[model samples]
Target: MRKLQFPVIFALFCGMVACNGKSGNDSTPSSEENIKKEEVKIRKPVDQAGYDVLLQYIANDDTTGLWPVPDQPLPLEGAVLPYNRIVAYYGNLYSKNMGVLGEYPPDEVWRRLDKEVEAWKAADPNTPVLPAIHYIAVVAQGNAMKDGKWRFRMPAHQIDSALAIAKMRKALVFLDVQVGLSTVEEEIPQLEKYLLMPHVHLGIDPEFSMKDGTPPGKKIGTYDAKEINFCSEYLAELVRKNNLPPKILVIHRFTKGMLTNYKDIRLRPEVQIVINMDGFGRPELKYSTYERFIRPKPVQFTGFKLFYKNDVKQFPHHMLAPEELMKLRPRPVYIQYQ
Candidate 1:
């Protein structure tokens, strides 16, 4: 782990500024049908000379730091992560009970999210913190729809709203899909347009991906490695075809049953996989769950989710600190506050 030099920092800042400029209008289309008609201009890869300079600086620098370096092992040797640390706000814009993301208006949400990001930055100054919006693009429902999917597909307007927020913050966006009674094959391709955006990523929640046609929230659902692999392959292909940087694919899990056949999930340079610990409980209970369910499984990267209300209800004292979470075997690169 090492801190990025001033030159590297400047390069990244310039790249981000350019990216923001390219992100045209913030206004969303009027309807979901029209959203498909609006084409997304593919992003070009980072300047090779600048990327090479940053890599050379990282390789030459020997300063130790409290956080891992972004792209430490290099893309050639299994490293695909773009940020040293990621802090995200998770939930849909419609439901406050779901998470903090929806608990406040857009301005307030950004304010709260920035507070968390600042905390992480202060805790680990060496690592660059990437702000993120983990939008619940598709929500599982108790009732079965006409298609019997038992899920509510978020309209493109909602997705665009999240993207607009992310653009304002110059942060990354993740569209989370809960495929109740539906297959990943059916859900993922629907978000292909958003996934093509440079800063937008993807997340699949196994806890709601009921393979048995059961309604969500009644019983824990499951996703096989085959399903996870499909997402990775799809994202990888997107990276290749668009000549963009690697895409991150987040998989939400808190129990063994949430993700089946984990051993068979494939990893590629074009796609970074994050096995996110998504359960909320007492601090000890949550840590134990992470150790048992997430620690044992070696994934490309790791993520942890914290519920602002649920976690505090059980703990009654305090939330897990960044230092405490960093003590895990493989430190989580992505953290979400729900």
Candidate 2:
């Protein structure tokens, strides 16, 4: 529940609208033709059908063509995004400060969570909103544990407990890992059993990924494209072998350093990556943070994280509502309340 800092960023640019073009058979492409350059990154045989679905899912205003990144590979079998919106409660069962999932009693948590999902559904009537339990499977610690890694794994029984709770609401389960001093390479394999399940997914917290041997809270952490791609490829293999639905990978970020090499993050048929705006603050502060980190770089999907406690500590003494978030240029499909 440490309140990470968001850098002071200026919202510099506005979403560009598609412009009309003149075709007079000029050898050089017109400014209108070059407009797609900023919107679409890499060009590939686009899945026009699914891409159209992505546009709708984001509630994309025609102003920006960035929501449907041009070359995303088609998902196999059951893909969640563009078809459904996710409302997740994030935390570890042991720590109440981490998020809402652990702040209240089990029955109360489910009751509140169901109401949140309903709110999102009411906000966007066309999309089916499902609940998700994003449990912190690996927690970053101030002290180096027995393995000399500044982290500890939650008990398997606790994860089983999370699965049990998910079953109560038929919610999706996400195992989030904050790999303190240890590498994700060492951590991810340990959770393969749970991840192989059809409904379970993965989340990696870069804010706790201290690669320089510094303690987790000493400074913000980071994840490069190399590490991110590894996670996607790993999940893709799981989907291929087990014939399961596309796995959703959530990456937490508030500052630019929390995630790097945005252009290199690949889009796979079996894995969908969501760059979650994890910063918490007043409405203006949170919106600036989102535009700074998420908008400039378009990932496969997008997510917005709200804090029940941290958010209310500011001026308005309130949390960002579903209606307010929907106004984002590329609306977030995944909503996590901590």
Candidate 3:
């Protein structure tokens, strides 16, 4: 039951880190038709480092300053202390009109990513030190590639850039997958290389994942326990195969129908699963949603997201403090301040 002593101060830091990127596609035969059917061979997984810093922060509950270690230490003038035990420094990058991951010259993406890393390295220490969570998924619909009929397609180069940035920033990269026609299981192979990186993670959106019978964005839920398990097992096996530490699996839940088996999600002992209640527009709804779906999960970690403009309309610009959120069961190891 630790409270964020200076909730406002923590909110400022969280605000700086939450960045969400966007994705789209055009006319084609459809991904299923376009992709060649072949026996998916097990690629040799690369051995990556473990989540030492995050584990330490959670084990001891002592992240006093901003995470990712800023290049410079800014003044923490009137900041309060005795804050929450665990929280993540969410990083977002949803700029408009960007080139594709593979299509974009490596230098361009690297430069942009590097600049962000430096900014984080410099700004982090000035605030509280929370684990850094990078939002690597494309936020917009137009960003995804058109592979036949499939609208949202994740390109290979995109995943590579994400991994490179994650390694450089010493942060966790959460691949925000917008589930359209492709299922979670379908994207693993493409992401396998990045997921091999120590800093990589996954976030599934049931919001975009329409049920077999339901249309997109409908109240109908998209994935069930089976899909969730498929992801869990894949990540777990990758971690084990590469002799890497546990990896985090993030799932997005907004409405009651997004994910029906949230409470029943199988928790893998070797893997960390963060159920992030992603939505905005209303503070009451956000908090209410978190309480009902996230707070009650048996899992050890949870995530919360804050929108800059979304919260400004309803409640005070700054909503719940880090300390206040930490009080929730399992504590929030993954925090997305988007």
Candidate 2 deviant stretches above 4 angstroms? 1-51, 56-59, 62-64
C-alpha TM-scores of all predictions: 0.77, 0.84, 0.59
Instruction: Give every collision pair in model 2.
Output: none
lDDT (tens digit, per residue) of candidate 3 on 173-251: 6676655556676665566777787656667777666446344444434667778888888987876676565666777
Candidate number that wins on lDDT, 1 or 3: 1
Worst 10 residues of 2 by lDDT: 10-19
TM-score of 1: 0.77
After superposing candidate 1 on the true structure, give the runs of residues whose Cα lies further than 4 Å from its correct spot: 1-82
Q: Across residues 195-284, which tens digit of lDDT does each residue of candidate 1 receive?
A: 998788999999998877678998999989999999999998988787667788999999999988887888776777888999888789
Question: Which pairs, if any, clash in model 1?
Answer: none
Cα-based lDDT at residue 82, candidate 2: 70
Deviation in Å, model 1, residue 316 alpha carbon? 4.2
